[model samples]
Target: MNKAVFPLLLLSFSSLFPAHGSGNETAALHRRYASAATEMHRVQVAMDAINAKLICRGCKIDVVDEIFSTDFRLKDQNSLGYDGKYSEAVYFDPPKDLNQTNAAPERALSYRGWYLAVKFDKNGELIDYYLTNIHK
Candidate 1:
């Protein structure tokens, strides 16, 4: 979370208290959560929520494959996964059924000149995120 957003969100928090009496709970709740969420984060969160609703493991894996589709490609989802060894497959192939390790390969990307490695589960769901930059 960005520390800068906290103060703004906290300012919006006070508006939520009056929502129950006015029968605008949904709107208020939306305001509460949406006040600080970026446009990109909303898309990512909605994607993850829908992905979680997939019942079958194969269905989930299928979503992983679709990650490379034009829609996702427009969102820059084609970042390659790496596992230190840099197998050609990791660089060239889509992120599905990673065989290198028990855990999924880290999907590496960059932002603001810093490198990031996003970890994932076997099913290709995001586990956590870690970023590092080479500094002198």
Candidate 2:
């Protein structure tokens, strides 16, 4: 075969069956993970804001409003298990003790434990948000 033709044939074969360790797929996955991470950060920030507001008023009603406005659906009648409408879901821990912290003079409410979960779709859209312990 002509030298030029041989190289062209090889190129076509390689394209049909890409060799292992090729960087393309890995790069794409990396991009997806990075995008998801950025979105999770945004959700976390928003949840933090809502948490601050709830802690300030110490009103269960206000907390519920803040949660629902953020696209969260309360799972239980007690207002626990808040679920987000976006791809990500957050689970907040119940308040531990009623200890007062100097950070906020209005009211000091201690949180038992809080957690945030982020779920992403193939298109990278947020699907769910969750918050727990609002009633507890």
Instruction: Give per-residue lDDT, candidate 2, residue 108.
Output: 56
lDDT of 2 at 4: 86
CA lDDT, every prediction? 0.34, 0.39
TM-score of 2: 0.20
Q: How many clashes in each candidate?
A: 0, 18
Q: Write the per-residue lDDT of candidate 2 for residues 1-136, one digit (tens) a residue.
A: 5998999998888555313322443343334433544445434544544444321222232233234233433333343223522232333433354545657656555544444443323332333435443434
Instruction: Provide the lowest-lDDT 10-residue window in model 2.
Output: 54-63
Error of 2 at 26 (Å): 28
TM-score between model 1 and native: 0.20
Alpha carbon deviation, residue 58, candidate 1 (Å) = 18
TM-score of each: 0.20, 0.20
